[model samples]
Target: MEFLIAPIIVALLASALALTISILDKHVNNYGDVEININKGKKVLDVKGGDKLLTTLSSEGVFLPSGCGGRGSCGACKCKISTDIGPVLPTEKPYLSIEEINNNTRLACQIKVKKNLDVYIPEELFNAREFSGIVEEINDLTYDIKEVIVSIGDESIDFVSGRYIQLVVPPYGKIKESTQRAYSISSKPSERNKVAMLIRLVPDGIATTWVHKYMKVGDKLRLIGPFGEFEKSDCESVMICIAGGSGMAPFKSIFHDMLEKGEIDREVWYFFGARTTKDLFLLKEFQEMEKKWPNFHFIPALSDCSPDENWDGEQGLITDVLDKYLKSKITPSKHKEGFLCGSPGMIGACINVLNDNGIKDIFYDNFA
Candidate 1:
């Protein structure tokens, strides 16, 4: 009787272990295949279901501009869906507007690929690429601004003149998850294998502080880019650009591209505002470029120049300097376009100045 009981117990234990193994396998490795139908018929991708839509699409080499890298915070990964994936998630609610929700738009990061999905994306996004790069050099462009040069590994990036890239910062000590931040490409478009960005250190900003304090030479980072439409148009109109602090990044790219391509036919006036001489940068480069491009003019304005600094230029607030220039230097009769980039406050002020001067075709990029 004892021998028969022992055999029965052994069989029961083996059955229990087999049941547990099957349950674990089902939970861990049972993601079924799913199909994503894009634009009804433009393209179709078959991928494993159960991952976030952003990650799955990115893995398939379909890059989407995401400032938070699919954490559902930046709300940059938004697309329209023809089929229902699931209800609107709480993480996506804050970023979606009422009109967006009504139009069947959803956050790609929040949606899970549980089943087959039909989604629509902008055609331009198909050109976006992700690149891995090593930090070549980091130089202080200004007191609080650092210019970082990243050398692309085996792949190269082809981006527009004034577009921006999202830099990926890995998790640090207190940071539980990685984060992404967008910075305009300061390097010329001709340098396809190397990208440069001018980053301003914001007091407690997660990414900026990391770049300023923790990041070192030769650190590896990933970047996803070529996003934004802040380029110079082909119209034969005067270009009036205004920027503050690190807002100089995009303008540098645009100006250099214009010089290299010999597209300096239209008159260009660049106004860079700073509190003092210490806050200013790239003056020598701009001066050299000004000599090269006869029609291009670079203006550096100091809002509060100390007497001891021997500063000599337009003074007062940036908007005030811009208003004076519009009234005195630039002619209102000629067709003009205003290009502005800066903090939200400075952009708003410059917009008002441009509007008051009858410059109707104003385009701007503000960092809010």
Candidate 2:
């Protein structure tokens, strides 16, 4: 009991010290107004200093893509700071490449706005806005995957298919602060007043927990979006799209948008992988799509499916199925491009398979 008490006292002291530092930083360290020059004068913000760059920008109506809600975990809130804001922090090193470090790219969430700074961001970010939405629908795509639809009354968002939006989860239960997470818009771009996201529950994940457990119909929500550069090419090359689980979101939007716009001339082969039939979703939806769009094909494979189950689709690792199709099923004469979205390991495996099939051009979004 005495040993446990010693550790408890140490933890208490550490917590007190942390709280004291936070209060001192918040109340004592006032850096006054700081000017943020964005995109070489395309936009300028005069904000209170001594706050995180991300919070400062958001308060000024500038929203950067922060999958972890400015917690310095997602590393998605990266921007080029041409001015010297000090060296890259240790928390940011794991996410940034050496080239990015050399270019002075820094995580906005980890940087403190101590003074005037020049930052370069994509012009499209200027169009991203915070939207007020009400939960309209929530359907379980699978045991783990959910289709969440939000209705944005009156106001509409204009975004290309395959882009993602950040869903803001307000504080609830034991959580003391709100958080935002990025989710690809599965709804078609033409449905401007509604947004749908396929969310896969991650154990103990702040945003996913709130989405799966706390979110309910008629609940008000905030979404900041139109971020991400994932989109279909206008070229005529056959598109070989591959995904697993919630990775299907972007492709769903892209295909629906293409179909709606009468751009089905391009051939597309979508390969969806899962461990079992129970893990798969949208079989009927994609099957109907395949029937309606002759040029589109949907191949769902299960690697570890039980023999007792009535499974008749491809059975093997996703890479193996992809390779098999590339060798025999797909036309060798036609130029092909690969679009992948999934875990880093899955994306790397698919890339190798695609490259071995004499395909070089590849684009991917890694859910890391």
Candidate 3:
């Protein structure tokens, strides 16, 4: 009977503590109203406090790019905070560099708005807008990849070539709340009225599952514009662009924008990688670009191509092929910059290869 009484006492204590904490959260945590200073007085907002900074800003129509929809998972909603809120959180430390942390950079989704705060926002983000678009078409790029084209009827979006947009996925089945995911735009900037992106299916992923299973050609979707700073540099260095699978989106936009702007004279070598022939797509389109543009070279490599197939292209892992070309075909003295997009693991591997080959000034965008 003593053991039973001890367990009951412990349970009662736990319940009392939970009740006390809940009551305190209801009364003491009500931080009524707060002022948000943006860009040193470019824009100011008065909002109800006690919400995450990301949600509060979105409520005021100043949407920051949040790839995880205020879940604190994606580090995309970072901003410089001038006012003292608190130290950096463990959730944000993985995303923030030492320099960023030292400079008061914090993730908006992780910070609660408890007082008046000053923050810095880019001028370009001020121009970003939410767009409602109809799905024009959906084509199978590969077994696992699908090309989605969205048309904003009579509306136009102006953005740089290598940028991304947040795709708003509505709740379905078990998902009760909406979420946003970022995908690089594959369409050229000239196609102002349309947005195209390549999405690869990820197992049990919220946005990808919606796009793959629930979306149809006539479905209407909401998109947030033209976020990201992954544009091509203006220097005359030889461009070494590497990508795999759906990573081809931004480069497709960049290359076509270059072609339209008559900037194809700059030397470019695009190295695309896949596991097998079935995983490859957009071969003919890029090959045609190579034929018309004298300085553009397209090299698609397969890592696990079977011996029975009559494949003549570069065969090996992408990093190995890149090292071979860097050592043999390309001139070592020519200045070069590496542009990469892929999964984080692939990007890490490619960066190691590029650094080993004496190439620096690398720029990359990795999908989460």
User: What local distance difference test score does each model get?
Assistant: 0.88, 0.93, 0.93
Candidate 1 weakest lDDT stretch, 10 residues = 22-31
On a 0 to 1 TM-score scale, where does candidate 1 land against the true structure? 0.85
Worst 10 residues of 2 by lDDT: 66-75
What are the TM-scores, per candidate, against the unseen true structure? 0.85, 0.94, 0.92
Model 2, stretches more than 4 Å misplaced? 1-20
Which model scores highest in TM-score?
Answer: 2
Instruction: For residues 219-274, write the lDDT of model 3, one tens digit per residue.
Output: 99999977999989999999999999999999999999999899988999999999
lDDT of 2 by residue, 183-238 (tens): 99999989999999999999998889998999999999999988999898889999
**Winner of 1 and 3 under TM-score:** 3
Q: Give candidate 1's whole-model lDDT.
A: 0.88
Candidate 2's error at 368, in angstroms?
2.3
Candidate 3 Cα deviation (angstroms), residue 315: 0.7
- Model 3 alpha-carbon miss at residue 270, Å: 0.3
- Model 1, 1-368: lDDT tens per residue? 99999999999999899679757654786569999988887889999887778889988988777866676777889999989766778888898999988888999987878788999999888888888999999999877999999999667888889999989899986888887888999999989899999999999888998999999989999898778878999989999999999999999999999999998787999999999999999999999999998999899999989899998777899888889888999877889999998997999888888999998898877785
